[model samples]
Target: MFKDSKKKLSAPATDTLLANGTSFEGTIEAEANIRIDGHFQGDIRSTRTVVIGESAVVRSDIIARDVILAGKVFGSITTEGRLTITPTGELYGKVAVAALVISEGGVLDGTSQMIRTKDAEPSASTDDSDLETQSGTRKDRDTSQATLQSETG
Candidate 1:
């Protein structure tokens, strides 16, 4: 009998919270989402979402897939997906984001750059002889490489 072809989906990402009045100073790296409601003075790196609460005060850089800010931040921020600044938020550093949203009353006192999404691959030309298909189009070599690796193993 043939095995099931579909891959199983993973569970949703979890969230970690830093409660109010808590103060921390160090680097934070996590796979789950994070919500901060206190004072932080270090860097934050996450593969999931990061949220800064209304009463939070941060003085460090943040890198995440998605970011939501509703507090006062005094450092730079980079997001792979979207960055949202709520009405009560105030950001005072540079930002590099794929997409950004700032609500009314939100303040941004620094520069920002819109970055391209990582999902878009480079276009391939058919005039090259490296990977010309029967239809005169270049095949995606990266996809074929991945498939071959998976089949061999």
Candidate 2:
């Protein structure tokens, strides 16, 4: 009753949320954008975007068009578009993404494999100013907490 199928096909997908102070464990498959700001343990398969808030703690594999991470994830993440990790984000598993952006303060403690996107040329380089190829020890960092401003921002 809340949505029409025709409109859903034409309109942009809405954002869905897993709020802070909450915990969940299961598989999630959706057409809309998904955001998490709490604890989760499962697999997430989405045709759209998936955003992990700075306060979130997740242990699941994620497959999405794009992912913006500002939290902690203990599983692999595969994306067709790009995976942007904010300063507070941390990932501990493998990632296969077409594009990746890790802010200065972000941390990734696993292997990252880059895939070629349709838009990228065969000779195009994946090395950008924000990307680095190196090996280092996983630093000991404390997980921070923050409150979500609104559900659908």
Candidate 3:
């Protein structure tokens, strides 16, 4: 038997609201999603996603899979996947992420570097080819080794 409750049984879990009246100063770790509407003064680390609500004010570094900001943040941010700044968001920090999106009215200060984690590893073929090329350059190696020996002597 399935029946709907007259009243809402549970609240949505995707969006966690730290209402305006609350203030926290510590690291926040969550697997789902988090939204802050209050003042926070610490690091925010998550495996899922994070959203800084428009009324929220944060002053700490952030690490997450994805982050959406619509508030004020005064710290560096590192995202494994993507980072999005909404029109009302104001961010002032360096950002390292795979991808970034900033709305027209969003404000971002400091540098942003897009890095690919998987691509950082050299391919097997490339490594092998590089090794082969280096090994084939006998003259270069000999000259360098000779110079090192002379300097030591």
Candidate 4:
């Protein structure tokens, strides 16, 4: 019925889980949340939160609304909301986020770019999907060895 369809549209998506001892290698695209407690290698794109459990080992590029890392990640991560790294987490790559929370004992061995909503004008929205996507050539800055950049509409 129409009522059921409406409910389904508004209801939260069921989270996808990869339990311990599992290993996945490829691209993962999801509209719902995902929790990984095993090993993953590739890219992960999601409209919802992505949680990497304490026993997880991830090596990929991640794009999501929010990312919670309590394990190890080796790649780039872009988050429109908040990126939280727990005490036992270790991240070894670049990160772009609106907000970042790193707990004690957490280690981030790369640069981070803080996306500013005010600077992203015209659209007046900070949603990642609203921005135009483009690939580019790299330019070395005189700053640190690491480079952080923000992409907006």
The lDDT per prediction is: 0.86, 0.85, 0.85, 0.84
* Cand. 4 TM to true fold: 0.69
* TM-score, prediction 3: 0.69
Give one digit per residue, the lDDT tens place, for model 2 in 12-109. Answer: 34488999999999999999899899999999999999999889999999999999889999999999988988889999999999999998899999
**Native-structure RMSD, model 2:** 17.1
Better of 2 and 3 by TM-score: 2
* Best model number under TM-score: 2
Summarize candidate 1's per-residue lDDT along 48-127 as a digit string, tens digits.
Answer: 98888899999989999988889999999999888888889899999999999898899999999999875654565445
Residue lDDT tens for model 4, 1-153? 345543211213448998889999999999999998899999999999898889999999999998989899999999998898988889999999999999889999999999875555456455664343321112234222353333221
Q: Please list all clashing residue pairs in model 4, or write none if there are none.
A: none
Give candidate 4 misplaced runs (Cα > 4 Å): 1-14, 118-153
Per-residue lDDT tens digits for candidate 3, residues 1-153, read 878755421222565667887999988887778878899999888887888878999998999888888899999889988888888989999999998989889999989999787977566676777787877798788999999999999
By lDDT, the best candidate is: 1
- lDDT score for residue 139 of model 1: 51
Candidates 3 and 4 compared by lDDT, better number: 3
